[model samples]
Target: MNIEIIEIPKIEDYRGNIAVIENDVVPFEIKRVYYLFDVPSNAKRGGHAHKELFQLLLPLSGSFDVVLHDGENQQKITLNKPDKGLLIKPKTWRELDNFSSGAVCLVISSDVFKEEDYIRDFNEFLEYIR
Candidate 1:
């Protein structure tokens, strides 16, 4: 998997820390944003890949592991710092695991919600990306 680590600048003030993800930050424009929080114990998520949209995943609260698989290769990323994010290009299968209790996983997507844009099957994703 061609995983790229994106270092996000944290803007900290008296109130709290703030991080912004604009269009020009990465290669793709932002069109959708969603966050995963209050996950149960031992629960895994995100077993899919986008066909076109790029994704930037950030752990806002605790820590989690992102497992990236590209057919013949696989990589695991342990994300704990809030000041950094992972930039995942299109056509890579990702799985979220080892989520700490009450951890928040924020996702910034490059496109709006489209069911047909996702490759749910690992073999299908491998074939489609190839």
Candidate 2:
């Protein structure tokens, strides 16, 4: 329910188009940047929730489905556009699946990677939120 779709700024041109993410665009000072690629179609990614981290996922190429749950509500969002981003807030569980061929998911994080910050169990996540 706290998920948000962010529209990245784009510069159109005859040659090509450019999408940029400035400091003001992402709503946080990015601490780490990463991406998911070369994922098998049958396989899935992201089966956890962060306690205090914020992330924005962008489909840089191809497409994929993002399943999000905020304890009481659940939603599935398909990411297929490079200029559009999915904002994931804290306390929400997420899972990525249905990846098209050559799908590339770019992630912008608000905090560094910390295993302790992740809630990998769905029941734990729900209990934590409650």
Candidate 3:
């Protein structure tokens, strides 16, 4: 699995800052958008892999860690900045953990919600990769 950290363009002013993201900024066009917030410290999310969906994750508020596996390799990444994002491709198993207080995770997906597209079982994911 290859994960890319993207630095989005940000405009800063006296009042606040703004980050702009369009279709051309990522490898896949955004088709769905969601966010996770007010999560408990010990809670975890995302324990699955997609067959075709691609995703970009941004830490809009606080911080969290994303653990990725490709059946052969595993990696953990920390997301803490609003201007940065992690681009996740298909066939990579992912787990989100170690969320800080008041953390907000913004996710941009390449496809709409489809239950069949998700590989939720780790054993099934390994078989699919082979």
Best-fitting candidate, scored by TM-score: 2
Provide the lDDT at 119 for model 1. Answer: 92
lDDT top scorer: 2
Taking all chains together, the TM-score of candidate 1 against the true structure is 0.89
What are the Cα lDDT values of the candidates?
Answer: 0.86, 0.97, 0.94
All candidates: TM-score: 0.89, 0.99, 0.96
Question: Residue-wise lDDT of candidate 2 within 1-130, one digit each (tens)?
Answer: 9889999999999999999999999988899999999999999999999999999999999999999999999899999999999999999999999999999999999999999999999999999999
Of 2 and 3, which scores higher on TM-score? 2
TM-score for candidate 3, residues paired by index:
0.96
lDDT of 1: 0.86
Residues 94-130 of candidate 3: C-alpha lDDT, one tens digit per residue: 9999999999999999999999999999999999999
> How many pairs of residues in model 1 come into backbone collision?
0
Superior candidate under lDDT, 2 versus 3: 2
| 1 against 3, candidate with superior TM-score | 3
lDDT of 3: 0.94
Show where candidate 1 strays beyond 4 Å.
12-16
- Candidate 2 Cα outliers beyond 4 Å, as residue runs: none
